[model samples]
Target: MLRAHTVEDVRRAEAAAMADLPDGALMQRAAAGLAAAVVDLLDGAYGRRVVLLVGPGDNGGDALWAGARLAGRGARVEALLLADRVHAGGLAALRAAGGLATRDPDDLSAAPDLLVDGIVGIGGRPGLRPEAAAALARFPAVPVVAVDVPSGVDVDTGRLDGPHVRADLTVTFGTHKVAHLVDPAATASGALHLVDLGLDPDELGPPALEALQPDDVRALLPRPGPDAQKYTRGVVGVRAGSGTYPGAALLAVSGAGCGLVGMVRYLGPEHIADTVRTAHPEVVGAGRVQAWVVGPGGGDDAGSMLAEARADGVPVVVDADALRHVDAPMPGCVLTPHAGELAAMTGVERAEIEADPLHHAREAARRWDCVVLLKGHHTLVADPAGRVRVTTTGVPWLATAGAGDVLAGLVGALLAAGLEPYDAASVGSWVHGAAATEASAGGPLTAGGVAVQIPRLVRATLNPSGSRPLE
Candidate 1:
């Protein structure tokens, strides 16, 4: 799992580590790591031109010291001091290493190979200073390597309120900040490289957010035991689609039949059910099921489907048209809502939800008393208890229609297989996103293509020996 800590947590850990270490030790370690990362980007330090955007605090100090190291290695380094009061010791070291320092932006005449953004670390607010903005505007094409975080992002909330440096590479120390994992800000943070400062894991407290890796998903995925039978594995029921949208029924059943569930039962309008049967011959009429997936293109009957699914007293995955009918939390229910659907549930604007997804998703989870899966570029699964798992896999091609229908059925199958609401939602989302990437293969894909790819993706994860790259 990729854990993202808040700024306060990082500050507390840094303070504790600094209290025991000698003077300047932490900064030196950070500087060394930052310099090494920049060296790797440049490939060879000698004769390369590097520019440092230095600010007032320790962030700027890190850049200055790193600039000093680059200068020592025969790189031409220039420091553009953006603040009136800079780190005096760091400036002296840079000067000692033959790095030029200037307060004027015009001193930077030619484009450098790389720009180091050390202005406004995790401590600063969302927007950039006028000087910083001007300096950034001067070099439109220069690739930036941000120290700790890209300057001016909301380090705690992952919100981007104003202009911030968009980094090509971010070399963060200690641990990942919330901005590194959460979107909007995460999109600005190009590629992340963590440099360990040896902070104790206990000191960092709990993570603000987490992204499940492949191994984490593998551990959570349902696997049959030696004595397991078809019935024991689990059965998932689908109550989705209507005669008006029979394709939704077929897509949902396709996802449920991905082998996550031993059986898939479909209950819907007669015409849609017939269509589902023809497309997925393995699907049967409604019967006993361990869990239910309700409401994708369910039309006017969505309310009845939700109520019936809730009456079963098993976990349910509520999605699409059923979202508005959800007045209170259902026991063991997972609510999947896109920005617009979430807006309708919470009475907030869709734009606002998209702007700050983490806050809105958590609020909805608490309000509805269930696991809320807010779909987006980075899908978020928030439990009522406040824990969150972000889905970091997927391509832009996944924005096509019918994707959510497939995801709802897949999650319901996992829930039937006995994974908790949180795990089922998180793992289902991870696999859904990964399957989209596999089906796309750098091109376009339909909802059916994505659904068909899920079993292959699951099989590869379940048996690594038979795995090959998806094309």
Candidate 2:
């Protein structure tokens, strides 16, 4: 899993590391890594011209140290101080290593091979200062590499406020930060690289969210014994589809992983169920089920399955129409709501949720006492306890009509296979996103196409080899 820590958490980790290490040791290590990355970017560092935009903090210190290293490698490097005062030791080290420091406004327009943005780091707001903004505007087309988190971005919330520098690449120290994974600011970070400072995991604490790796998903997958039959794997009951939207049920069942699902039980309209059976012969009429998936396209009849699933102690995935039916707290329930549905569920405006999705998702999860999955660019899975996971993989092409249905079905399969409500939702979201990426391949894709690609993508995740293991 790829873990991401908050800005405060990263600062705490840095403090702990600096306590044991020498005064300038961590900055030196950071500079070394930064210098190596800059050198690799250029075909050869021999005679390349590099410009450093230095501010007044450790970020500027890092740039000065890196500039000194580049000078030793025979590169023409210049540091332009954006502030009156800079890191004293860093400036002295740069001058001692045969590097030139300047405060010339005329040289700001000079087009260099690379520009290093050291104006601000994690301890910065969204907007840039007047002078800093003017300096950045002088070179509109330079390829810039950011030292830490991109300057002028909300390191904690990932929200954008005013003028911000757009970097072609960002090299962050320690582990990943919240801005690197979240949107708005994340869009400004073109490419990312992590520079490890040997931070302790305990100091970093548990990550805010993580994207499950293939091995992680494989380990979490359930297995059946030799004597196991169809029912042992688990049955997923789906109460989706109406006369108006029979295709929703078909797409949901299509995306449901067949290997992990013992059988699919249909509990809806006869005509719609017949259509589902014809498309997928393995599905049968409703009977006993281990889990339930409610409201893909059941516009009005979505609420009936809540009592049914609750009484049976089966985990339930509620989506679309069922979102409107979430009247009270239901145990073992996972509610998947888009911005509109979330607004309806919370009786708040949709714009409010869109403006600040992290806060809204957590609120919904708490109010309903269930797992809430908020759909957006970064899909957030929040449990009733307030823990959250964000999925950042899927392509924009996956935003089609039946896409939510497919995701809902995938979660149902996970729930049936024995996972906690939050894990099943989060892992299902990760797989759904991965499958969409595999199907799109940088091109356009339909919801049905994403569902069709699930089996191959899921199998690849489980075994990685060409063959599947015995269940």
Candidate 3:
């Protein structure tokens, strides 16, 4: 699992760790790791030209010390002091190590091979200073390496309000910030590299955000027992599709009956149901089910279907048109909505919801007292209790039509398989994304193509070495 800590949590943990160590030891550790990463990027620092945008804080100190290390290794390192008061000790060390430092903007005439952004750390607010932005404009095409979190990004919320450093790589110490995992800021953070400072895990408390990795998803997967039967395993019901969109029903059933659930129960118009039965002969007419997925392309009849599904008293995966009917608290249901649907449901602008998805998702989950699965580039599943899990396994090709319907059905299948609302939504999203990636192979794919890849992906995930299972 990839865990992301808040800025306050990071600060608290840093203080606790610093108390146990020497004064300059912590900065030295960060500097050594930063320098080593720069060297690897340069493929040997000899005769390389490196420039550091020095600020007034510890971020600048880290850059200065790392610059000193590069200077010692035959790199022509120069520090551009952007602040009136820089780290005195770090500046002195840089000068002793043969690195040149100048407060004059004219000294920045020669653009270096790489730029180090240490203008603002996690403590600073969102925008960059005029001089800092000007310095960056001087070298428009240079690859940048940010010290910790990208300068000028909201370290806690992952929102970008103004000018922020767009880095090719960000070397974070201790642990990841919310900005590194969440979007907007995450997009600015080109690639992430962690430098282990070995802080106490106990002091960090619980993470604000958690991302499920392959191993974590594998552990959470539901495997059938030896005596598992059709009824014993699980049954997922789909109340999606209409005369207008029969493909929605087929796609939803395809996802639910992808060998993850034992049986599928499809309840829709007789015509659409016939189509579903024809495509998936194993699916049966609705009778009893462990879970129900409602409203994919359901038009005006969505409310009635949702009401019937809710009457069954089973966990429900609400999507598309059904979101508008969600006026009351469902308690244990999963509400799947894209930005536009979510905006309509909450009466907030779609732009606002997309800008700070973490906050909006959490608020919606809390208000509805259920799981809010907000689908996007990085899918987020937030529970009423405020815990969130980010799904980061899909490619851009997964944005095609009917992909969300497939995801909704998969979530219902997981729910029927007895995973809690939170786990069901998050795990289903992870699997759906992985399946899309496998199906696409860096090319275009339809929603049905994605559903067909689930079983193979699951088998591969469970048996990464492709060895025979103990059947």
Candidate 4:
């Protein structure tokens, strides 16, 4: 799992580590790592024109020290000090190594190949200072390498309010920050590189956000035992689709039939049911199921389908149109909604939800007292108690029609396999994303194509050595 700690957590960890080290040792370690990353990005430091946007704090210190190292290695490093009070020691070191420092923006005759943003650290507010923003505007086309994080991003909240550096690559220290993984800020933070400070993971306590890796998902997957039979694995029931959207039922069942569960039982109109049976001949009509997936393309019949699914007293995956009928607490259910659907249910604007999805997803889970899966570029599965898992594995091709329908059925399969709502939603989302990536193969993707690719993706994940790459 990729765990993202808050700004406060990183501060505490840094302070603790600094206490054990000699004076300036920790900063040197960070600087060495930062310089190494920059050199790697430039292919070589020799003769590369590197510009540093220096600020007042330790973030600027890291960049100054790194600039010194780059200068020593033959890179022409120039620092534009954006703040009145800069890190004195770091500036001295850069000057000693033959790097140029200037307070003026137009001092440089030519733009550098790469821009380093050391304008603000994790401690600063969400918006950039006028000087820093102006300095950044001078080099509009240059690819940026942000120190720790892209300056001016809300480190803890992942919100981008005002002027902030858009880094092509951000070199983060120790653990991942919330801004690096969560969206909005994450969008500005192009690519990430972590530099370990040897901090204890146990000391960090719980993370603010967690993203599941392939190994983590592999461990969460359910495998049948020696004595397992078809019924022994688990059965998932689908109560989705209507006359108007018969394809929704087909898409959902396609995901359910990816072999995660023992059986798939879809309940809808006779014509649609027959269509589903024809598409997936292995599917059976409605019977007792361990879990239920309700309300994909359900239209006006969503309320009634939700009522019947609730009567079964099993864990349910509530999605699409059925999200509207959820008024009270649903302890064991998972509610999956896109930004617009969530906004409708909570009376907030879709734009508001998209701006800070982490906050809105958590708030919705708390409000409904159920697991909430807010689908987006980065899918978040937030539990009622406040834990969240963000799935960042999908390709942009996943925006096709009926994708959510496929995801709903996949989550229901995991729920039927006896995973908790949180685990089921997150794990299923991760797998769904991975399947989409495999399906896309750099071209347009279809909803049914995602379902077809699930088995291949899961096989490759669990058995990486011999399996083909999803790409």
Candidate 5:
């Protein structure tokens, strides 16, 4: 899994490394890596015009040192020192390498092929300074390579507070930051490249969220043995849809019907149940279930079934309409709530939850004592213990109606197949997102199409060469 730690975790990791090594060794290593990437971008560094927007701290030092390396390779480099004070050693090294440092902002009209933004790093707050903002406005056409992080982005929170630099490429030091995984800021970071600083992963504190790599999800997937039967694997009971909306039930069942799941049970209106049975004859009515997916379109009727499932000690995935029925904490339950449902659960306005989803999702997880999966641009899955995983692979086209029902059912399938609530939710989200990508293919996709695409996507994730790409 690709893990993204918070800025505090990164700072601690950096501090630990700095204490073990020489004073300037970390900075040198970071600069060397940055320089190499910049050179690669230049193809050959003979007479390439490189511009560095320098700031006051170690971030500026990194830029200056990288500029020196480029100068040594015969690249004509210029540094625009925005701050009054700069890194003494790095600045002197750049000067010795035949690089010129100036304080004027107007001279930035010499738009180079690439701009290295050293204006702010992970430690700085979001939004640009007066001088830095003005200078960047001059070169709208130049492709930017952000050092450490794109300036004016919340490094720790991944939320964009204001105007931020949209980088074509960002070379970050040590580990991936929260901004690299979370939305808004993650979207601003065009293409990310990490420079290994040899920081110990175990030494770092808990990460904000983790992205499930193919191998990670593959390892978590359930495999049936030779003697495995339909009843032996696990039974998932899905209580969703009503007379008004039968398609929600159909879509959820489609997501859950992947061969990974042994059996699907229906408990709702007869017509909707008939629709599910018509589409997939394998499903049966509610029997003893290993896990339950309660919600989708069954508005008020969801409460009783959700309560029954919660009382049975079976792991339940509470979603959509059933979100209101989440009365008390269930130890092994998973709650999937979009912003509006999350607001209802947390007793806050939908706007407030939308503003800062990470904070509110964690709050709900803790309060409900269950795994909370908040659906949005960057789908966040948080456990009651505060561990979180963020899924970053969906597009705007996946926002169609009944999309969430498909996701909830997918998670239910995972839960029935014997994954923990957290792992099941995370893995299910990964599959849901991947399926959406395959279904969309850059154009609009219906919710049904997304659900239909899950089985192939799941197979591809499990065995890379075993499945066909969605056409």
Candidate 6:
């Protein structure tokens, strides 16, 4: 699992670590890691041009010290001080190591091969200062390596209010920050690298967010035991689509039948049922099921389908048109909603929900008393108690239609497989996104294609022979 802590938690952990160590120990560790990461980015330390955007706080100190290290290894490093008062000790060290420090950006003869952004730390508010913004604008094309975090992003909320440094790579110390895992800000953070600061995990408290890796998903997946039978493996029921949109039923059933559930039960209009059975002949008529997936192109009968599914007294994965009918959270229910659907449920504007997805998703989960899976670039699966798992495996090509329907069915299958609502949602989301990536393969993909790739992804995850485990 890739766990992300809040700014306050990181601060507390840092303070705890610093109390027992030397005054400059933590900074030295961070600087060493930062410099090493920069060297890797540059492919070598010798004869390379590097620019440091230095600020007033410890973040700037980290950059200055890292620049000193680079200068020691023969890199042409320069620090463009953006603050009125910078870290004096770090500046002195840089100067001693043959790195030039100047308040003027124009003192640099040319654009450096890479830019190091240490202008603002996690505690800094969103949006860039004038000087920092100007320096970034000057070298717009240069790739950036952010220390701790990309400056000007909300470290706690992962929201980008205005101009923020978009880093090609972010080297975070101690642990991952909320901005590194959540969306909008996460989109700005290209790739993430963690450098251990040796902080005590006990002081960090619980993580603000968690992301499931392949191994985590593998461990959570419901695999058949030696004595397992078909009934013991679980069955999932699908109540989706109608004559108007029979494709939704086919797609939803396709996802449910991707080897997660032992059997798929179809419960819809005869025409849609026929279509589902034709596409997925293994699907049987409506019968007893461990879980039911409702909504998703149910058209005029979505509310009825949801009502019937709830009456079954089994876990349900609610999606699409059925979301509007949800007043109170049902027992063992997972509500899947995109921004617009979430807006409708919460009575917030879609733009507002999109702007602060974490807040809204949590609010909806708490208000409805269910696991709310808010689908987007980074899918959020939030439990009623505010625990969240972010899915970060999909590509941009997954924005195709009927994708959510497929996800709904996939999650329902996991629910039937005996996973709790939170685990089921998180695991299903990870698989859904991974399957989308597998199907896309750096190109366009349809909803059906994503569904079809689920079994393949599951096979690979269950039997990862030589592949590296997801971190």
Summarize candidate 5's per-residue lDDT along 22-128 as a digit string, tens digits. 99999999999999998887797778888899999899999999999999999888899989999999899999999888998666547687789999888899899
lDDT of 1 by residue, 71-118 (tens): 999999999999999999899999999999999888875889999999
Which of candidates 2 and 4 is the stronger one according to lDDT? 4
TM-score of 6: 0.98
Model 4: residues with Cα > 4 Å off, grouped in runs = 467-471
What lDDT score goes with residue 299 in model 5? Answer: 73
Question: Which residue runs does candidate 3 get wrong by more than 4 Å?
Answer: none
For residues 117-230, write the lDDT of model 4, one tens digit per residue. Answer: 999999989999887888888889998999999999999988889999999999999899999988889988888999998887777779999999999999998877778887
Ten contiguous residues with the weakest lDDT in model 6: 462-471
**TM-score of each candidate structure, all chains considered together:** 0.97, 0.93, 0.97, 0.98, 0.93, 0.98
Report every candidate's CA lDDT: 0.91, 0.84, 0.92, 0.92, 0.86, 0.92
lDDT score at residue 34, model 1, on the 0-100 scale = 95
Q: Which of 2 and 3 is ahead in TM-score? A: 3
Task: Report the CA-based lDDT of candidate 2 relative to the real structure.
Answer: 0.84
Q: What is the lDDT of residue 396 in candidate 4?
A: 90
**Candidate 2, run of 10 with poorest lDDT:** 252-261
Candidate 4's TM-score: 0.98
Sort by TM-score, top down from the best: 4, 6, 3, 1, 5, 2
With a 3 Å backbone cut-off (N, CA, C), the pairs that clash in candidate 4 are none
**Can you tell me which runs of candidate 1 are displaced by over 4 Å?**
465-471
The better-scoring model by lDDT among 5 and 6 is 6
TM-score of 1: 0.97
Candidate 6 structure lDDT:
0.92
Q: How accurate is candidate 5 locally (lDDT)?
A: 0.86
